[model samples]
Target: MTAGDPGGLDFWSFVELANRRLAEEYGFKHQLATELLLTLNRASNIVTYDLEASVHRPHGLSWSGFRLLFVTWLAGPLEAKKAAELTGMSRAAVSNLAKTLVADGSLNRESGVRDGRSVLLSLTDAGHRDMIEVFREHNEREDEWAGVLSPEEQRILVMLLDKLVTSRDQFDVRGRN
Candidate 1:
């Protein structure tokens, strides 16, 4: 539906019809593929937004900034590219986020010792202490979100998602086939 449409469509009805049409008209292998992906996308947005507002923002960290610090804290010092790969963020984003974190005294970015062209990121002492406290609160938030599902249901969902995500070996960050 476009913005120029005369009437608004019911979301559930629209999705149900769209999936049926995909199966009938396009011969889709999975009729609910679009619906499943859309749900997952929405879930991601909701979780991230909630976490940022409740956990990260009060700590003076953006979501990207928090991820950078978290990864650096978990793994020791790492080059920007490695940080990007671990956090699923772009190298440029890691760079920009790292600058703010470093300026805030939460992270330290320095020229690589062995490779002068590379820059390494590591959490400062304050960052390490801060993250430890933030993590306690973060775990509580995680429990709140997961509590929506039964234990068995949550376990099954994790298993299924892991299988689907890890099954894709044909692609990489560079978009390689």
Candidate 2:
């Protein structure tokens, strides 16, 4: 399907087609391509897209921008590199977004004491206020998404995801030898 096609297949439909094609044409393993990783990727995209549309966009923030504010608000002052690590963003990306946030008065950046080359980031008073307000609505969206699964299922899913993340070094992203 073309990128501009309104009738383009939904994500799972594309995944299903890929799974079949891989199995038939390349003799790939069905379980590996169609199961855990694809499902997690799809869910992550949908959830992020919905959150951006429903909560972040109305507040004049992109999801990543909001996340930067949220992390700083929750963690107090942190070096830009630290913020990038905590937010799962690249250092350059965090630095760039920080520039906009600083200009907008949502965050403060100051030279680091321990390192002359580093900058520490913290929420400004206005930034803290805005993030707190936005977070209340963000939590509501989270609740709506979590409502799809029962509490037990939610707990189990969290545990499973944690397991995978914590064991990330075990997985080889490049082709296995």
| Most TM-score-accurate candidate | 2
Using Cα atoms with residue i matched to residue i, what is each candidate's TM-score against the true structure?
A: 0.83, 0.86
In the predicted model 1, the residue pairs found to clash are: none
Model 2 root-mean-square deviation? 4.5
Our tally of clashes for model 2 stands at: 0
Off by over 4 Å in 1: 1-11, 21-29, 170-177
Among the numbered candidates, top lDDT falls to: 2
Tens-digit per-residue lDDT, 1-177, candidate 1:
432353666667677777877787778877567888877888889899999999999988888888888899998999998999988887778888888888899998899989999998888899999999988888899999999999999999999899878877857634311
The weakest ten consecutive residues by lDDT in model 2 span: 1-10
Off by over 4 Å in 2: 1-14, 171-177
Q: Write the per-residue lDDT of candidate 2 for residues 1-177, one digit (tens) a residue.
A: 422453767777777767777788788875563677889988999999999999999999999999899889988899988888888888889989999999989999999999999999999999988988899999999999999999999999999999878887787554211
